[model samples]
Target: MEDLAIARACAEFADDKKAENIRILDLRGLSPVIDYFVLCSATSAPQLRAVRDNIEDEMKEKHGQRPLYKDGNYESQWLIIDYGNVMVHVLTPEKREYYALEELWGDAPEVALKSDEPAPEPKPRAKKVAAKKPAAKKAATKRATKKKAD
Candidate 1:
C-alpha cells in the first residue's frame, strides 16, 4: 500500500484503540525522509504498546502489510513502527508533548484521521480589517464627536 493509504489505515486502527492526537504528516517534500509520518499518543506505557501491536496486526490483516523495521519497545515511552513509506509513532502523553512531532515537522501538511464522530465545524475566523491610518482615525474621532454633539 502507498504511504497515504497506510497512514489512513493505521489511523483508523489507532482510533479503534482511542488513541489521542492522531495525525498524518506528508513528509515527501520536506526531505528524502519517509513519505508520511503517523503520530499519536496513548495514555500509558501499555496503551502505547497496544497501539504499536495494533498497527502491526491491523496492517497485516487489512492489507497484508508489516513494518519494515520496529524499535523503541524496551522503554515503551515511545514506540516507532516503520512501514517502508510511512512511519508510525506511538508515544505517551509526556513524550508526545515534550517531543512535539507536529511542531518539529510543521512544514509538512497534516492529514487528519477520520472518526465515527462527526468533527465540529470550524469556527469562523475574525476578519482583519486593515489598520486605519492616523488621518482616518482622526476623521472617525471627529465624526464620533459630531454625532455625540448632535
Candidate 2:
C-alpha cells in the first residue's frame, strides 16, 4: 500500500478501537526520513493496547503490511509502530499532551480523512437588529406610512 493509504488505514484501525484525537500528518516533503505520521490518543492502558494491536493486526491481515520496528508499551502510555515510510503513534492523553508531536512537526500539513457522506451545510446566522428608542420608532413608522401614501 502507498504511504498515505497506510497512514489512513492505521488511523481507521485506531478509530475502530475508539481512539481519540486521531490525526495524520503529511510529512512527504517536510521530512526526509518519513512520509507520514499517524497520531492518536487512548484513555487507558487497555485502550492503548487495543488501538496498537488493532492497527497492527488489521494492517497485516488486510494490507499485508507490518511494522518494521515497534517500541513502547501500554504501561509507558505510548507506543510506536514504525512502518519505514509511515510511523504510527498511539499515546495516552497525558503523554500526548506532554510530547506535543503536532506542535513539534508544525510544518507538516494534516491529511483530511475521507468520509462516506457529504459534510452538513452550515446554518445561516440570524441578523441582529438594534432596539429603536420610542422617538426613533415613531419617526420611522411615520416615514414608512408617508412613503406608502406617496
Candidate 3:
C-alpha cells in the first residue's frame, strides 16, 4: 500500500482505540531514513499491545499489508512496527516523553488527523512575558540624576 494510505490506516486504527497523542510525522525530507512515522501512546502494556494489534489488523485486513519488522513486544515498553514506507511507534507515556521522538525528528512535517471528533489542539505556546525594569536600572537612573544635580 502507498505510504499515505498506510499512514491513514494506522491513524484510523489508533483512533479506533482512542489512543492519546496520536501523531503522523512525514519524515521524507528530514531524512532518507524513513518515509513516515506514526506514533501514539497507550496507558498500559495491554493497551500498547492492543494498539499494535489494531494497527496490524487494519493494515492486513483493510489494506492487505503486514509489518516488515516489529520489536519490543516482549519488553512491552515500546513497540516499533515497521511497514517499510511507514513506521509505527506505540509507546508508554514515560517512554514516549523519555525518548522524545517528536523532538528527535522535529524537522518532519506533521499530519494532523481530521475527523468529526477534532484532535486535542497542540499545546498552547508559552507566552514570553516582558521583564520589568530591574532595581539596577532604577539605581542607574537615580545615579545619572544625582550626577546631573551635582
Candidate 4:
C-alpha cells in the first residue's frame, strides 16, 4: 500500500517538474519481486537532474520514503530509483526510446495518477480600442477651466 502511494507520488512529482511521457506500470500479479514501475522522460541533462532532485525531496519529505537502491548519475541518460516494490526510472528521450519500457513491460497494467496541478485559467486581456485613452490630467484641466468660467 505504501509502495503504491510512493509510486504515484513520484509520478506526480516528476510531472510537476515538467517531466514528459510519465507512466506508472503495475507489476503486482506479473512479477514477484517488484510491484510498480514509474517511468518518465526528461528532455535534457538539467531537466533530468531537476526531476531526480524533486522526486527525492518529495519522497523524503512527504512519506519518509528513501530509495533503497539508486543507480545512474544525473549526468547519465538514465537513472533508476528503487524503493522496495516501487521503481522509478528517469531517462532522456533517447534512452526511453531505446529501452521502450512501456513496450517491454507490455503486460503490466498502467496506473493512473491524479495531478495536483490545476488547469491554468486564462488571463483577462485589455479591451482593444481604435484610439488611445484620453489623458486624465488633460480632462481634469479642462473641467477645472470650465468650472472657473462658470
Candidate number with greatest lDDT: 2
Instruction: Point out where model 2 deviates above 4 Å.
Output: 115-150
Which of candidates 3 and 4 reaches a greater lDDT? 4
lDDT of 2 by residue, 67-116 (tens): 99999977899999999989999999999999999999897777875544
* Per-model root-mean-square deviation over C-alphas: 12.9, 16.5, 11.4, 20.0
lDDT of 3 at 71: 88
TM-score of 4: 0.73
TM-score for all predictions? 0.73, 0.75, 0.73, 0.73
Angstrom error of the Cα, residue 63, model 1: value is: 0.5
In the range 56-112, model 1's lDDT, one tens digit per residue, is: 998999899978999997375888998987899988889889998889988777665
Report how far off residue 34 is in candidate 1 (Å). Answer: 0.6
Cα miss at 68, model 1 (Å)? 0.3
Q: Where does the lowest 10-residue lDDT sum fall in candidate 4?
A: 117-126
The list of candidate 3 runs beyond 4 A from truth reads 74-76, 115-150
Q: Each prediction's Cα lDDT score?
A: 0.81, 0.86, 0.81, 0.84
Q: Candidates 2 and 3: which is better by lDDT?
A: 2
Candidate 2: Cα lDDT at 117: 31
Instruction: Return the clash pairs for model 2, or none.
Output: none
The true-structure Cα RMSD of candidate 2 reads 16.5
> Which 10 successive residues of model 2 have the least lDDT summed?
117-126
